[model samples]
Target: MSTFQTPQYTIVELLNKAQCGELQLPDFQRPYRWDDERIRSLLVTILRGHPMGVIMTLKTGGHNVRFKPRPITGIGHEGLKEPELLLLDGQQRTTSMVQALTGDGVVDTEDARHHKLRRRYFVDVVKALGDVREQEDAVVSLPDSGIVTGNIGRDVVLDVTTEEKQHAAGLMPATVLFDSARCFAWMMGYQQGAPERMAVTQQFLSTVAQSVQTYKVPAIELDKDISKDAVATVFEKVNTGGLRLDVFELLTATFAGDGAYFKETGEDFRLAEDWARTEEVLHKHPVLKEMRSTDFLMAVSVLITLSKRRTALAAGKTGKQVPQTSARREDILSMSLDDYRTWAPQLRDALPRVARHLRDLHIHESRGIPYSSQVVSLMIVTTLLGERAEEHAVRARLNQWFWCGVLGELYGSTITTQLAKDAEQLPDWSLAKSSTTPEAIIRASFAESRLGSLRSRQSAAYKGVYALIMAQQTPVKDWMLDQKLDFQSYDELQVDIHHVFPKKWCEDNAIEYWRRESIINKTPLAKKTNIRLRGDSPAVYIDRLDAKGLSAEQVDAQIATHAIDPAFLRAGDFDGYFQDRRRRLVDLIESAMGKSVVRDWNVDSESTDAPANFNEPAASTGGVSIGGEPTPDRTL
Candidate 1:
């Protein structure tokens, strides 16, 4: 069967349908955004009998496709009514025409600069009939007051605030264009007021005004039996608005169309409001603050699909008959409100537990998280594990899989397919339900050579190394204060990643840039301590720390906590410190990833030699600062 039909609708017919609550917009449609200039151009097109464009709509009352319907922007009706059609495209054009050609003719639009405006459109009777090229100039947009003023509102340049003034000036109100009775009465008043130009008024009425009154607009209407996904795909392709509609928006519309939900709640279920409340709850935990609405929906999808797969197995379905567990877009779009209700609260509780797990790994803030995308799989796996997630053995296995994803840099690209795999396998492996290792762990491999390129937080492994060092079994400590860097001090003292050997010292001593700025040379430090060590050598700073209060032994102990070789640091031996710290960082990564990093000690020799001056322009290398002072070739 044909899924759609191309039909023609007149401007008056569409406007009348809008006025009587027959034609409406789907809830997912963006609001009218046509500015004053565009509205004027549309009016000019109608007056000149030019085809504006085609509009696309969906027939309502389809069993398969249901979206909450809303009235056109300027339309007002006494009570809600079931709309026969829902506009999917050409919203801006339809809204502009309805406001300018019907009702009060005062369009609630914006200026070219996007400033709000309330305007009424009119056509000069004589000019509209003069030259086709001058049709645009004939269209006038005035303020809602129907007055144009000059000289700081002291002089009235033009006034059409009353019907008498409109008739005397021979200006035809666009509001009367679509209504025959109103158009006839206005013409009669204009002829009575200007008997000398009676012939001109009649000619204007017959030619110019008549063109606008009988404008035909092309419309393509989708059949009522089209699927929701088909409607979404067609709407995105035809919608002139630039923003692409997402699955959340489609589901929000579908959920609102649930007549049962409205009957019970006495109002439409607002998914946006529910998401805002979810954010309020999740924000209480810093590690979970980065969770997006789509991420939550994906987690719910994983849970629902997993249940479906298990149900299929229980029903003795085999092979292709069983549903594959999925968090894909198609699966998420098919989710019912009942599915969300079943799993949303469980996933919400599981997310905070995920945050605690991340805190245990010393990822104290959302910014420190290596891959925020991995959090979804973790939430689902943790929820499936239930109380067993707290057990040491289960957590150990979960931590291994997480670090494999991070240090392996697997979650940096498209991850939906891998996420589904982990959602299905990780919990089963953790519970000993299956002996097969999760694909994330099996695919995980880290090379020793990646350390040279791991200069910025932009790399997931760099962040993973930082977190591992801070989260070492023996707590790390700040250089000056000798305070233990736990969760409390991590936040209270305002810690951040900073260079160890100091960029100034490296440049002064002619160390290679790659080795100098590498993640192996950085560690988390208190903000005040970083300020104190600005552009100074480690040897210089260690003595200053000693002079402040701490003995040499205490300073060395604090330095050792960060996996640094204190003797190499105290001797100002860059080569020895870099090599020793590299091995130590690799060990920490291996312990977390549950795999050995391939050693390529000569990888640094394969790179270009450092420039003789070891100094480059700040822009060539990402510009950096120490205590907010710019230095050449410095990187954070």
Candidate 2:
């Protein structure tokens, strides 16, 4: 049965009473979460006579929650207490009306998170201040810094002439909903969200904010007598965020729904908050951002695992709850959250050849996991494989399937497993068949918007980098994979990408010419040497080939295969570097495609040049490298 409560009240009346501090929130709640335009808009909607929704609350008869209405306009949020009333939904709309009509307190809406993402339920002080009296030197002038905690991140003191209604409350859009003292209001006249493309008129909007103009469910009263888990079940089905509520959230709601202290701000919220901070870091990184949210989630999983805090989120009230701190926060919020960033340093110190081994998955796409999930799965797998392992490279791709399969088996994981299953359906011998390909991901990523717009989190340009990597690596794995020279395992392999002119060096000299992800900067080398010698120019790198027991000629020949410019290498820059490499890799890919045939080169075989008949380049030039012109495929 539905626990939804159906009730209605004037937003203006709620706001008027709330401003006088007649409303308060349950002790189990957190502070006001909604931001500026959101709260102001509620007032406008109510003034416009727009139909708002009803509010729902749980009935707790002295279990432990005691809340006195504060002079706060919107609902207040404090820690949870036992046997208290809990708001199940309609929080924003109701609180908004309370803030607007009440003179007791004002809601703060400064949208300061990350970068001014105006959270709903926040107040607009500039507008609210107009109703106050100007006792300060004729008129109160706000200082440069007047925003308080929980307010959007605006840097202005909101001192206003306490005489005008406009100054009394910030001008807000028409869609905000506020939870007020014993009342709430929003555009509830229509049912569900109207699809009129914000059809609310500008005139009405000037008065009532442009909020969702619909009258959906009013409210539902929750019986305290019922089990909290049952109440949680009702909430899980009722609250929004259409995507499934994360595992912990569901568990928390169900497990503690009836406790007066369980309504809000529990272990799950803390975990999500921590995850969000980490998500902030990953979104900024080139590698992590290239992966999907699932992949990012995996990274978080890996971090949590490595941190030995795996159970922190789901841990119920254990004294060792997840530590919330700014320093830990930096792990996710301030830096690049890439494999290179975390494992890079570790890999550099422990296994210099990490990049070569890492890219093996790209050569042959593995199925059964989404790329993001795989990344997480891979991190865990890699952790399981141990660090400083030079020979574990080949298993990199293999472990992806193994460990991920186990995760699926245990958690009933769907997304990652579905991705794996989906990859098998792709064309044969394609790069995506081995590991997830950038192209496959991109096409799938924006099956909706090819031009750009990866998501609200990452940018269009960033997605391009991932797409580019996939294009170069995955499409021609049969031919490309062979470049490693025929060994089942990455360690047994004779050749790997050797930066002929180390990228770090090239970057210094030819800053403008060096391609960010150039194919030329890469060449085949032995597993051992690539790690020992990093960022060396072609000449220096060739000289150091002995560390891997390779002769100078072989090293030079290996570098030649990539055909990067020696002059560019010498100058360390190639304005034409990327374009040239793009042409070469594309040409190579095309030649591989045309060949109805593919053969692995034996690195150890002391074979002479191919017979004249076999030396001819293969059949079709399948892909067009993004160079100035399309060149014919030339297979080595």
Candidate 3:
């Protein structure tokens, strides 16, 4: 069946329906924003009998698509009920027409600067009758008071406040154009007062006023059987000048229109209020704040799909007859309120658990999260597992899948597909219900050369390596503060990623730029500790630490916690330190991914062709260097 029908309605019919509450705007439609000039131009277009554009609407009685209905702005008829048709597009144009052409001719609109204005429209009958081309200039907008003033209201330039004054000034109120009785009465008054201009007034009434009364606006009425997603999609396509409505906005209107929910609960369902409360809960856990409303809705969709699949299987449906689990956009759009109710609390509870799991991996904050997208899958899989997610063996498997996704960079794109797969597979795989490895783990691969290009903390792999280093069997510690790199100290000490081998020292020694800036050469350190490094060589820094009353052995032990070779750092051997640390990092990644990394020992030599600057002067700064820029002592 065709989804819509193109029907034409006269301007009189559209306005009458709107005033009587038969035609209304959907809640998803944005408020009217047409300025005074635009409204005047629209009046001119109607007077000229020109095609403004098509208006799109949806039949409102359907069980499938329901949006809360609101009267067009400036409409205040008592007991306004549910509309028969919900205006989807042409809201601005239709609203401007309704306000200007009906209900006392007063329009609540804005000026060019978006200043609020209450205005009444009029047609200068003299100018309108003069020339056909001058019809547009005939429309005029005045303040609601129907008086024009100059010099800050001290001078009254024009006053059409009464019917006699309007007739004398040759101004025809636009509000009377749609009402034949009012239009005829205004014409009789104008003709009786000025017998000499009777021919011009009759011509103006027969032409401009007649055109407005008979104007036919094209409308596309969507069938009541169309789906909610289709309505949202169609609204977006037609309303291109407006903001695009997302799934949450669509659901907000859908839930608000749910009469069944209102019957049961005796109150409206507000998705935004619920989300705001959920957001408050999320803010309590810093890492979980990364989960957005869309992500939460996607998780709910996945659980609902999985629930349907389970029910179908239990009813003996098999193979092609069974529903496929999905978290795709279509599935999210089709999800019901009951489905959300069934899983929302569990998913909300599961996110905090996800945050705890991240903390266990030494990822204490949102910045440390490698892939925020991965959190949705984790929320779903963890919720499905429940208490078992806290079990040692199950957590180990879950950790492996997560690290594989991060190091492999698989969650950067096509995330919804991956989210569905992990939602369906990870729970079974982690709990030993199936022995097959998840695709994320199977497809995961880390090449040795990526480490050279992993220079910025922006890379997921770079952040992953940092977390893994701190999460090692022996916890990494601050070199100066000697505190374990756990969640408490991580924030309390203001730890940040800093260079292990000072950038200035590396540059002075003519090291390759890529090697000098690589993740392998950086580790998280306390702000105080980084400042004390003072752009000095590792050999010089260690001696300074030893002078602070720390034994060499204790200092070396702290360095070892970060997967570094203490002897190489103490000896200031850049080559040995770089090679040894790279291997150690690869080992940590391998353990986390539960897979072997492809080895490329020669990657350092082949990665870059930029020559070392052996002739550049070695500039010194009193403060530590960060990212190769020197800072003075006070600046630290």
Candidate 4:
């Protein structure tokens, strides 16, 4: 292998050669995610002639690399052939420069299906140039050309091809990312267009070109000693205190580190001021978004695939060599993206079967695992069965796999071996499990367990677990779609989870915790009624309505079946009618599970579940609990 030397490369010359396709990005590169503020800041720095870093690239074998365009629109080059040039170290600055100085912006991408690819847009270079100048220069007419430049808002034309000077404003003839080669100085600073600054910028460019003669770029060479894991560590170290680029950022550079960038990988190259829209394609995909459920885990998983073939954590990180990491990279790129397009049919078919299996199963806690085991299972199931998880038959496979993990015993969940066991047994199990609903599978998983974890639905323990479990994917709509939970097709009427005992009222009565927030106490009601009843005491609310129209008895009757018509709107007398409702809920909970919880309190008795969180009678006044503080009671 040749040792890396500081080769002389002028900024303009490098960019021009790159325009013919020299610099490239690897497949792991993500689209731009910076918002406008950051983009403007970078452009200002460059336009002011601050030296941006060198455009670094690793030398590689003569094999041509593919170069995908940063998701941008307009007159930029859309594709470049191999040996592709990967953007290393200076992506942010480069992208900002291209987007702001050039009028080229990523408008919309079109897939082969001709579906208008929804892309995030970026500020054209004209806007960026406008941002750096004094405010007065923003609207100033330029020198007989549409080009707007600013030292202090003066305008200059870099290129003018249109017939009319005024009509040219629409063109804003400047170099964007696509046509950047003509106007860029990648390793140098930008030449500002304000009349005085233009002279200075031109001087700066010339000086930069001369400096390349001995420009010692303090650089590390990409070599066999640098494995993917090694590269990841290096990245983590560099970003200890600063804002860290995510794992994908590191992994992309590693793959393209040998200076091979792929043009079709769809990296976000600052097409929009809103950086989140950078990778509109990846973020919009149901599968990619769904897989992104848990950021840390998903981050590692994506990089693992990209770094080298799908490594199963078994490959010890001690390889300490380049070829091995490169082989792994090949495996990552080897995984067929074609699998993504076919995901809907495959995964969608599996979710319902998995949902049915989990719909009624009683999971237990209090023994093998502490309290809050149910949520762990819930998160895992949701992930494996959530909208995107259904891709590639993830649900049916996960359904079968989960059953296998639990079939060993009731408290059979082992984070370590669960995925493996399921993976091992699933091929045959999926056949029988998908076609046949395994009632035994649920019992097989939780029989010896207490099932107490299932009872504390509204506890903080449950909420924390839930928050940790979800992947926290963005564009929440994509996730909902993956879960098949889109409620749009349903009627105007909707079901809302409402507090049956009127939490605020319970607080006043000192039994707030159990009665107010217990998942057991939550019920479905019409959306409007839920809002109207927000915190009204259910008993008093019903009693007040009696004067208007509804008899307390009639309200009680209606509530008994979990149905309510808001005929007594705003009357606020819903509580006198709750004793029967509480009883119904208890009965319903037991009925739903074919078992009973040891709830001894009566709905009519003033004695309540206030003591559930250990609050005694002394603390029960003024809506306070034991210790003269509010306690979370489990009964009402």
Evaluated with lDDT, which candidate comes out highest? 3
- What are the root-mean-square deviations of the candidates from the true structure over C-alphas? 5.4, 17.9, 7.4, 14.6
Q: Could you estimate the TM-score for every candidate?
A: 0.92, 0.35, 0.88, 0.44
Q: Best to worst by lDDT, what's the order?
A: 3, 1, 2, 4
- The lDDT per prediction is 0.81, 0.35, 0.82, 0.35
- lDDT by residue (1-636, candidate 1, tens digit) is 899999999888998888888999989888788899999998888888889989999999888878998999988757746799999888899989888888788888889788999999988887788777777688988899988999999999999989999987767888886677788778888888457778976887787667767779999999988887787677568764657677778888988887878898799888787778778878888877767677778778889998999999999999998988877777887788778878887887776788789888898887787776687788888888887997898888999999999899787656677778998889878877799999999999987767766776755677899889998889899989879888889988899999998999899988778778889899999998988888888878878888878899998999999999899988878888988998998898898888899886563563423333222212212322111111222110
lDDT (Cα, tens digit) per residue for candidate 2, span 123-219: 3422322232311111111211333333455543343223232223332222233332121222222211444413432223333232223223345
Candidate 3, residue 107: how far the Cα is off, in Å: 3.7
Superposition error at 217 for model 1 (Å): 1.9
Candidate 3, residues 1-636: lDDT per residue as tens digits? 799999999999998889888899877566788899999998888877789999998898898988888899879859776699988888888898888888788888889998999999998888776566788688999999999999998999999999999998888888887777788788888899568978976786787678777889999999988997787678668768777777787888888888989999998788888888778878988877655677778788889999898899999999988887877767887888888878988887787788789999988887678776677788889899998999999999999998999899777555677877897789999999998889989999997667766776756778888888888989899998789989888889999899989999988999887788888899989999999997888989989877777799999999999999899988989989998998999999999898899886573463332333212324434322111222222110
Best by TM-score: 1
> Residues 489-567, candidate 4, lDDT per residue (tens digit)?
1123343345655778667767535334543345544454555565766545545445546565655444433423233
TM-score of 2: 0.35
Per-residue lDDT, model 2, residue 200, is 36
lDDT of 3: 0.82
The TM-score, computed over Cα atoms with residue i paired to residue i, of candidate 4 is 0.44
Clashes of each: 0, 103, 0, 59
The clash number for model 1 is 0
